[model samples]
Target chain A: MKRIAGKKLVFFLLFSLLAAFPQIVFAFPDEGRFVFDEAGLLTEAEKEQLEYMAQELGAERETEFLILTANDTEELDLSEYIGKFYDAQYGTVATNPAGTNAAILALDMENREVEVAVFYKAEEYLNAARRGYIIEQITPYLSEGDFYGAFSIYLQSVYEFMGTEPGESPETDPLLPDPVMIGQEEPSESIFFQWWFHVIVSLIVAGVAVALMAHHSGGRVTVHSATYLNQSTSRILNRSDNFIRKTVTKRKKPQNNSGGGGFGGGSIIGSGGGITKGGHSFSSTRGKF
Target chain B: MVIHYKCQNCGDDMVFDSNTGMLSCHSCGRRDRIEDLPEEFITARFTEDEAKEYHCQNCGAVLITEKSTAATTCSFCGAGVVLADRLSGDLAPKKVIPFTISKDEAVKAFQKWCRNGLLTPKGFMTGDRIKSITGMYVPFWLYDLNSRVQARAVCTKVRTYERGDYIYTETHYYDVFRDINLDYVKVPVDASKKMNDELMDKLEPFPYDRLKEFKTPYLAGFLAEKYDYTDDELTERAKGKIANYIESYLSSTFAGYHSVSYQQKSIHTNKTNSQYVLLPVWMLNYDYQGKQYLFAMNGQTGKIVGKPPLSSKKIAAWFAGIASGTFFILTVISQLAGGGF
Candidate 1:
């Protein structure tokens, strides 16, 4: 009877172990090469800084994150080139297939574009706010042709940003250090997070349907094409446009810490991204340095 | 009288082929030029004051297509005949834009419209589905309205500038007035009660220069209708069209203002004229899934318009496709474009 109780307890413990942490199901992704500074633009000191940051982040996150800098892309579309380079350098594993847990930031000095490619969960985790915040910080340096300084700051920010949770929730885990951000952009004040975005999508789709429903059943609205009317016979009596009241809307402009801000708290503004090959997707906040 | 041209080479029937816009013999493929149409047509009233039957002189076969059909081919003998009594007097068309689009072309247009985006049911464009094709001469009354428009508007201009940490917007308001006199020429409304007003409106701006004098040859081998609505009745609809046109015209003059609101407006007509006429249309009727689909194309300009039957199945599929796409994409865009939350 005692042995039976012992076996039941063991089974129960094993089941709980699987259930408690279902998401940590697989082994950590293999750490591939993390830096491809082919541009040779980075000095020895700058290269060392990137190498250390890349190695540390790779060890901590188990994501094959890379920081590549090249003088000019060889006639390849910058975004496409970044995707191909990411696939070749790390040759993503099937386990972390879309690099969902991985990311790569490629900076091109000659053509002047910054690309951050994220795979799999990294897209959902890194989020747009973080991407925009990071880009705002590094733009000023790149515009001034400071490649080493730009990359040096970039490496540090990525290390710090990866620690921050997705969605930038107010509650932070006590164990992990909060992110240190540069160019601290202000978060949105409105609780209407994606309202406009939702409205535009709804409008386009509904417009097509509403338009189809409106006249599809057969009716006609006389258009404003009165130019067909005889213009010479009609004379103007009186016409004028009078001024009316003006409305003032105040948008909470983000606090621009372009001077020097680290990733503590800031919302990314005007960041855009899209999907790449092999079904791998990426999100980025970028500025020209 | 309806006058149909015949093929001299063969005893078979001939028709005014719309594809070639000429009188072509259907049996022998011979084409003939119609030179006597203008002189043969007379605007005098019919002495009989009743509809008349026409018999082919060549084969002694009675020619009948539709009650309003002025000209037709003998089904038995394949000879063309024109009903002299039907188009004798007031029944004669004052002007005509002959059928420029052929039957095959109109059928092809219907097929293309049906298959666009798979909006209709499967096999809706099957050739066997077309029930009938009729070349119709639809009657209309053209109105020329000359009017002076008076309008008063309150307009606004807004300017914005940033100061320190705040943005300021200044709006200036003014009262404006405008008086414009305009002449509208040839706004037409269908005068035939048989024609659907909505479908007729889609066929517009027929080149008036092509309108020849009252002619008999133009009505050959086609269905036609005489105007049923008098000038007094059609004037009302034409006036409404003119008023709407004038209102929009007056409203358009107030450009460059931030905003404009109407105060008062008046349109005074100086002159109005109405003329009875006929326009050509190619019509195809299709009955699909127990519902009728009517397709009409302008005979002059080939501007085609029709209401396609909505496929419930296709609509459901489209909604599913668009909804899923919008849902996934909008979510991703909102996160990437807006705040993290």
Candidate 2:
């Protein structure tokens, strides 16, 4: 009886270990990672820095941020792929996990496209318009093949927006206005549109025109020096040129170090919000590279 | 001292005709070539005191004249008179350019020129408001000048190239010297004190090919003036005119240099010859807005020189239009270039 009990215990231990393997892989904090670069678009150093930033911000905001890249989605659409990934990690709508907030940024290399997927409480902050604005800001960096820049902007924008209330401008403090709003309003009152600018310019033009007209009213002198010159008798007698000294100067040339080569001919996709097959509601903006 | 030409066919006084270039009769349409006339008729010989008052030959009226007036007409009789005493001896002119443009042609040309003034005041172009237009013979001195120029300048030549990671600039300095001789002929200087020098200078380049030997008949009908300043007194002015030409010519010889700065330069000029001559001009007096404006036209070439009053309202409108156009263009350009980048 003792020998039979030992064998059964060993079998039980093996079965439990086998069952726990997937749980470890799918767990969020267990992996302690936010970026998965399947496309190999970012350098190792860039990936490290982004990981550090996402970990710090995610902890502070009490949310999970995930950035994913793929060589291609094959026949599946980018949104469908994102939904499947989200379901595999957090379960489907029928078995949806409670008290979880996750914002996912996914890029598909083959289509040169990017999309965002939000889960749980994140949906309340990043609405369609706000998500579109974030994507618009990062599209230029993505199209330039600056994946590192795009990821950093994504993390920062998400953090700032989540801290503010819904239906509000994305400002760090809700009481103060957005800095970008001030910038846009300043130009309308610029000197180019002012009354004094037009008046001063017109006065200058009028003064010059009148002066020129008055000057030319008196006719020009038609007779030049050659008009009365005795050309035959005029001659050059002597000429000499002696070189005195020589000097030389040298200067170092300037160098240019631009970021990276761009993925040319990139374009934007349609933007909208919809519930995934897993019943996770999200607002997504599409950008191309 | 006043002499008048009498028409052989009719006893009426004859006047010099600009169109026919001959002595013409008004009552009878008879014209005589002064060149074919007797020497006595062409040259008037008279002895009179310079200070004495002169009377018109046709009318016994005392001619109101200035001291420098050589030829004028009788205001009462409207007869053409020539003062022979003032035109002879030391006050004589060597050459004369007779009036090729008549009084009617000059008036018409003046009106056309006025219409071409873009900034002139309203209705000023009609030219019907001219008070008087006088055909006058103005005295001038034509000078021949020769200049000797010697110059020394420091010049440089620069070359730039890229080698490896550095840009190299090489400059070579040169010491240049030049000797030149420049001669200008028939540079005219107006000797009349009454005429504006600036206006007269603008009406230059009279056709010297039409110059003829001076005869009293050329001044029979037109008013003439003797020289207020002699050629010897105006030599300095002629020299000043040719100084700019000499400097420009000196610089032309020192070409092919990046930059040139003159260290030392000398120019010595000498007057070779000067002759007294009479050139034709049409003077116009116009009255506008209680003000008198004077205009002068070259009788031989019909070149006009004068300033016309400008309209303030038109200038304001033009300024507004240009400013608006420029502003519109700049705004569109900035917007199209993504807010000027």
Q: Which candidate is the best by DockQ?
A: 2
Q: Please, what are the lDDT tens digits per residue for candidate 2 over residues A114-232?
A: 88777677887776545665666678788888787778778877877678665443444342234334333445445654545756766677678767767888787887868888999
Put down candidate 2 lDDT per residue, B1-341, tens digits, no spaces.
Answer: 67788788888889888998888898898998877765453345444365479888887899988878888888989888888777776677888999989999999999999888877877788748899999999999999999988889999999999999998999999999998888899899999999899899899999999998888888878899989998999999999888778877888888889999999998999999998899999999988887888999999999999777777776676667777776676655534543321
Off by over 4 Å in 2: A1-152, A155-206, A254-289, B38-51, B326-341
List residue ranges in candidate 1 displaced over 4 A: A1-207, A210-227, A231-289, B1-14, B27-30, B35-38, B47-92, B162-169, B205-210, B339-341
Model 1: per-residue Cα lDDT over B1-341, one tens digit each: 34555567985556666666566776678876544334644554665445456666666666665665555556776555666565556555556667777777877766665665355557664535888888877877777777777777778778878777766777777788888878888787887777888788877767777675555556566667766767677777777777777777776787777788878877777436766676888887878877777877788776666776666777777666775677677766645544332
lDDT of 1: 0.63
Q: What is the TM-score of chain B alone in each candidate?
A: 0.82, 0.91
Instruction: Please state the i-RMS of candidate 1.
Output: 5.9
- In the order shown, the candidates' Cα RMSDs to the true structure are 17.7, 15.2
Q: Each candidate: what lDDT?
A: 0.63, 0.77
Highest TM-score model number: 2
